[model samples]
Target: MPVDSTGHAIVAEGLRKRYGGTEALAGFDLAVPKGTVCGLLGPNGAGKTTAVRVLTTLLRPDAGRAEVAGFDVVRQAARARYHVGLVGQHAALDEVLSGRQNLVMFGRLYHLGLARARRRADELLERFGLADTGAKPVKQYSGGMRRRLDLAAGLILAPSVLFLDEPTTGLDPRGRNEVWEAVGSLVAAGTTVLLTTQYLEEADRLAAKICVVDSGRVIAEGTPGELKGAIGGDRVDVVLRAADEIPAAMAIIGRVTGGEPESDPDTRRVGAPVRERVAALTEVVRALDEAGIVAEDITLRRPSLDEVFLRLTGHRTDERAGERAAEEVAA
Candidate 1:
């Protein structure tokens, strides 16, 4: 049951949101093609969630404009709400209710008749791989199962667009994989999903395009590969046995790769971006050997999304998450 949305399903222009002294969004802009997954990639407190809240009509922007599924988010709030579904970071299932009952209850709250609600619940259970456990109480479900059910509850009416905010935040790897498969199936069925996450790997796997935001503004926007390329093509890394040899290794690697090398004195490691993989590796190994640096590790690999995020956000994802957590506790 596909909804009536074609072309760009979501659009935003110069969005701005300020929370007292903090500016969560500053001139943010976006465009997401219909039927494709678009990722909002940023560290915690980078305004990813704030932007989602504004677009989903939960928060009004201080300035700028946004449209979802062809409806203005502010002026047409009711119609926009009807076409979009939201799944927040935490699970919101009723602990005492069976998975099927929870979903049916959501449908009923959406004004679906009892019979239709039951049918929708069954469809969601089967689609999200919870058919076997539909009768089981939500408390009996695992982390992944509960998250999928949350997504299903958001989709009570087959919304044309869905917003997921950190859907895999605390799940184990297997659980994350399960949620990923469920999202993939939804996209295949023609739902345009806008996902916000701190995990770069999630955007790489699920998003056709990624928007990187920091300090309330979009710093970059492109396909995953394109964003990685902005940092560099390939990465050459070396780990030395002696921490005292950091300077020598950094110089050699910097000169060989022609890019600034990052030194990790804590780990006696150095890494730099490389455009010519084979040639750079050869030069780096030869230089280290001539300089009598006993490297315990040397490898060439493509830049991970972590590296991309670091370059775009100017901070490590973990560091930002920790800072945000501390701020929340203090507040």
Candidate 2:
């Protein structure tokens, strides 16, 4: 289904949230087009969860406004709920209920007739590869199986917009891939999605556009390629034979590339960005030859999402101190 170009599936302007002394969201803004997947990528305590809660009408924002599926999240809470589905980090399943029953129950809750609900349940069971296990109690299912059932439950009503929060957090690699495949199919079928994840690779793989939140605000927003390109130019890696010659190699590489070469103290490797690959490589080789520095290996690579985050925030995503500070502020 083609979405209206003038309308937005999700829109927010100056959204803000506060918890006592903490500020969870500070003038946050977002716009997600219908039939597209927008990713919310951040480390823990970056307000990714809070933003999702507010947009889904689970929690109210302190300031600003938001709309979901053409309904105001606050003023038209029930209408917004009718058109959106949410799958949180943990599997929200009834242990005693069978997989098919779970989907039917949710379908009924959405006001579907018994016949239509059953039909939808059957379709979802088959689509999520849970047809064989549909009669089994959820308690008997594995982690992956339970997660799939939870996802199926969310889709029972054929919601127009889906909110997925760390959908693959606890799943194995194969399970994660399965979920990704399902998400891709949903987008192809014209269902918009808002995904939140701490995994950089997950965001890079699934998101058409990524919004990076840090300290309760969006610090960066763009496609994966755009964000990587923003970090500027290609990177060249040089592995030296001797650790002691790292400084000398850095000096040579830096002069050649016209950029400061960063050295890895542990691995004795050096890297720098270069605008002209061939010219920089030639100059680097010549300079290293004069300095008696033998390179064990040389390769050119593009910047990864990790490097992009580091460059933008001046810290890695896993840094506990920064996360704690953010939590404290958000709390």
Candidate 3:
């Protein structure tokens, strides 16, 4: 029997989970539209993994309800499992086997016959840009190749809802880009993806919608631009020629922007949010010149998703993202 379809690929309401006294999910709720990518973001220990586990049927929620592909996670665990797929932080691949073999094995596990498995493996290999290396040993493949194979295995059954928990965790810039491109291809084919990642840029680029979780619940949710707008708009930054000019610059910036300006002692730079980028920048420059303060640098910049995360979640996006990485992204 086919499950009834709905506009939402996944939905949850008032989900709660407790590990001893730790409340992992306190009334967590979300609704992801079908055929779109949704990014789940939060700081470390934010219950992101727990939420994925519950939705994938790996961990049952202590209370509330979740539906994936129109099947209840708890009551319809068996049915839900069939319509969902999971790709964890690490690439789940057999180093000794060739890429094709690994994918074929996944197909077989999903009950496809040997002939069908081979056909499916070939199909995925080509689709994921692994056709050239499909016959090579997994250990001989690049980090990106192996990650693509892991993603291919997950799609063997073409499950409607795919759970990606930090899918690009430790990949090099090149490798991460490859995986992202592959994910983009899948979503274009109408796959509904639930991505949990530490990269706000990733959410900004890939997620049609983003849900920021904190203390086991959603703190804010919106598109990347919308989230950034919630905190304010563009920012004007000025680097003083001398560190001693910080106080003077701060006052000028504060008065022009109607907001407190932030200072960086080391860079001798001052910055503040502004609604009008051009007007703010112009006013700051005019004021500094009249005051005989020389600014080594002055510019207006748009707010980054990083700023949004910090203002809403009470922590820097890099709080858990390790050292800041170079801008890594893909189609």
Candidate 4:
């Protein structure tokens, strides 16, 4: 299938899917432009993986329509498959096979000639920085190496769009960073990527735009900064030297920021959203000094993606991840 002239690598509307009594996807919608990364962020059972399956033609939606690389997912499933690659949560590789052998096998499975398959395998091994370790058995590879090999397998045909569903799950920080760098390199060469991740920081770093999914619907969509700004601009936090000073500090913060302040009594910390970032911090400091209150620390900073997610969804991404029966059904 050729790339879509509309410049959207993937598009979906009113997608609905159900597993038994659970509605995995309810009126889900998405549009991802070519040559960019779009992130789907949500807790378990929010329909992220279900949406990916439908778009990739692995699972059919009960209703609605979608297109990938100019082909309708349902009407032209084969053609759609030709233009997209999927790296699922679990590794889909033969542990007994070497990394290079695995990629070569994938190429041959796609009907590339043996010589062409070997060439593509070598190319990908070098491209993903696994040239030296390409001959090592996948079972002996590090977590990051196995994942990079999985990514290489997904790119045997140089797909136009790639769907990554929690690609870095269970990886250590170093392994995760290695995958992130590889992904960045791919995007630089103009591959459209749709990433679904529970890691807010991953989404923030990789996604050009983010869709916050909850209850099978997108409750918010924007760039990371825009999403953070949607809830509140910047925040001022002050830790008092003594627990008894929290009340006075909250009052000072409230007066300076002109917003209601929240306090953690146990930590003796008071914080509030402030529109004027630096000015509010300065005023709070001056007010505390005038009131003869000592502050252990004071700082003003933009809200984190985690804070934005909590504010929008009222829960963390990891919360209920293992408890969602609907997710189990979808899986």
Candidate topping lDDT: 1
Reference-based lDDT, each prediction: 0.86, 0.83, 0.85, 0.85
Candidate 2: tens digits of C-alpha lDDT, residues 1-331: 2323266898888889998888889888888998889998877778889999998999999998888898888999998999899999999988999998988888989999988899999999999999999999999988778778888887877889999998987677777788888888888999999999876667778899999888788899999778756665567889999999998888878888987579997887999987787788878888888888899888776554455567888877666634432332222
The alpha-carbon deviation from the true structure for residue 77 of candidate 3, after best TM-score superposition, in angstroms, is 1.9
Q: Where does candidate 1 stray beyond 4 Å?
A: 1-6, 276-287, 299-310, 313-318, 322-331
What does the lDDT come to for candidate 3? 0.85
Tell me each candidate's TM-score: 0.87, 0.83, 0.87, 0.85
> Candidate 3, after superposition: displacement of residue 85 in Å?
2.0
Question: For candidate 2, which ten residues in a row score worst on lDDT?
Answer: 322-331
- lDDT preference between candidates 1 and 2, better one: 1
Angstrom error at residue 213, model 3: 0.8
Superposing every Cα of model 2 onto the true structure, what RMSD results? Answer: 5.6
Model 1 per-residue lDDT tens digits across residues 1-331? 2223357898888999999999989999888898999999877778999899998999999999888989888999988888889999899889999999999998998889999999999998998989999999999999999999999999999999999999998888788889899899899999999999776668889999988878888889899889877888678989999999999889999998999899889988899999888999999999999999999999886555456667766666566564543332222
Best-first order by lDDT: 1, 4, 3, 2
Q: Write the per-residue lDDT of candidate 3 for residues 90-206, one digit (tens) a residue.
A: 788989999999999988988899999999999999988899999889999887788888988889999999999888877887888898898888899899999998677677778
Off by over 4 Å in 3: 1-5, 255-259, 274-290, 296-306, 313-331
Which residue pairs in model 4 clash with each other? none
Backbone clashes, each candidate:
0, 0, 0, 0
Flag the better candidate by TM-score, 3 or 4.
Answer: 3
- Name the lDDT value of residue 318 in candidate 3: 51
What candidate 2 gets wrong by more than 4 Å, as runs, is 1-6, 233-241, 252-260, 273-306, 315-331
